[model samples]
Target chain A: MGRVVVEVMPKPEILDPQGKAVVGALPRLGFTQFVGVRQGKRFELEVEGDVTPEILAAARQAAETMLSNPIIEDVVNVFEAEVSA
Target chain B: MGRVVVEVMPKPEILDPQGKAVVGALPRLGFTQFVGVRQGKRFELEVEGDVTPEILAAARQAAETMLSNPIIEDVVNVFEAEVSA
Candidate 1:
């Protein structure tokens, strides 16, 4: 199976409460080396055949339309993943 | 500033309902070249300094202990990302 990985994140201008909570808790966990944190979603998709530009384009569309809310989120990256059985 | 991206995914043995729902809806949306899909979480952390192995290790621990439930989820990969301002 071919694969593609799409990342959906809150747009840079948006506030991420979950991310802030995690960042706040990090210091309590004795981790103070971090300056900030943002959490997002990843979709690892198994395509029907070899991953090509066409497949990636379709995947990007799927991500934009199905996986993310374009108003509040951004599709950060699309990666051709190594698919193994 | 340095950065580390940690991806957390449900274990292979686990079931992913959200991914299934998206995959199920794909064909209805007129795109059906996919076999399966798995959804996961991505953490983008901005560290105080450059991302080194030590920083990666700390991030891994943060992911394993704080970000993910190791019993049901797995931390897949850790990448060093370019921190642009």
Candidate 2:
């Protein structure tokens, strides 16, 4: 099956509490190299056939409309993903 | 500054309610080309300098131990990301 990958991230100006929690937890876990952390969402949409341009456009529209809140998040990426199986 | 991208996804055998909900909602929204959906996580780790091998290793470690729950989730990808700014 063909798959499409869509990535969504909080806007740069938005405050991400989950990411802040992760940043706070990292130092305690002895991984202090990271200066910041931002948590986001990844989606995989499965298709029965090849990922056509129409499917990609539909996925992008779904990403912007259903998957993410445009005011708080940005659709950072939308692309066809190689399916291993 | 440099960034490292980490992706985590639920195990295939695991049930993903959010993904299922998306799949169910897709057809109602008039985009019915998709067969399935899986929701996961994306994390961006910021570093003060370049993403070195050591940082990559640390990110991998963090991904496995902290970012994802080994019981139901898998760390899918960990790589350096080019920073535009």
Candidate 3:
């Protein structure tokens, strides 16, 4: 098997309300040095077969088509590895 | 400066509706092998000062207090590294 990791985030120019909210709350939580915070999503998957270029391509396509919002978000990164037996 | 990486995810027992929606959309996007997909958050921060244990601790605390929802989510991982000058 193989494992896939995908990270999704809002486009840098877009305002991240979720991130802003977290940043705003940091001071109350005793985090005085924290100046900013941005929130995004990570996805990990265990695929049921050998890792191949075709599989990776399909996975990337899947991410773009269904897993992420192309207009408001960006696909930050995608990584894959073999699952240990 | 330092860099902080935080990954947040739903508790394993909690049903991830966003993940489910992604899984449902995969098939339509021509990804037949994808049986499941879970989504979470990743935060990468460039701190403005040297890397220290105290900074790392504060960052973790901030993640717990404001960056994550403790009830329905779990802090999957937190990592820190010194930034190259």
Candidate 4:
């Protein structure tokens, strides 16, 4: 088995209201150093196959095409790991 | 400087409409996976300070409290690295 992890986020130029809210809330949480916060999403998938480079590439393409919004968001990172038997 | 990367995802029990849609779209992209897709986010912050354990902890706490929705989502992973000068 293989595990794929993806992180998706709004493009830097786009306004992120959720990010803004979180940034506003930070002072209440005792973290006042950050000038801003940008919110995003993370996905972890378990592929029922060997962890091969091909599988990783396919999954990443799937992520880019279907899982993320190219107009407003981007896939920032992709990580894959072998599932130990 | 330091870099912080966070992955945020919805709780397993919660319904994920976006994930479902992506899962449905994958076959068209030639990925006939076993089943399902869950979407999430990633954040990379360039912290302006010394790269210390304390800074990392503070950033993590900030993520957990303000950035992530504890009621519906969880912070799955946190990674910190020193920014190369």
Candidate 2, pairs of clashing residues: none
lDDT of 4 at B37: 66
Compose the digit string of candidate 3's lDDT tens values, residues B1-85: 5678788888878899988887787777678877667788888655677657887887788678767799999887788843443
lDDT of each: 0.89, 0.96, 0.76, 0.71
Best by lDDT: 2
Highest-scoring model, DockQ: 2
- Residue-wise C-alpha lDDT for candidate 1, range B1-85, written one tens digit per residue: 8889989988889999988988898899987877799999998999876888888888989998999999989998888987654
For candidate 4, give the lDDT: 0.71
Docking class of 1: high
Tens-place lDDT digits, model 4, residues A50-80: 6578777877886688667899988876778
User: Which one wins by TM-score: 2 or 4?
Assistant: 2
lDDT by residue for model 2 (B1-85), tens: 9999999999999999999999999999998999999999999999999999999999999999999999999999999998865
Off by over 4 Å in 3: A81-85, B81-85
**Location of the lowest summed lDDT over 10 successive residues in candidate 3 chain B:** B76-85
Residue B16's C-alpha lDDT in candidate 2?
97
Instruction: Classify candidate 3 by CAPRI docking class.
Output: medium
Model 3 DockQ reads: 0.61
**Number of the candidate with higher lDDT, 1 or 3:** 1
Query: Mind giving the per-residue lDDT tens digits that candidate 2 earns over A7-81?
Result: 999988999999999999999999999999999999999999899999999999999999999999999999999
Q: Report the error of model 3 at residue A25, Å.
A: 0.6
TM-score of chain A of each: 0.92, 0.98, 0.88, 0.87
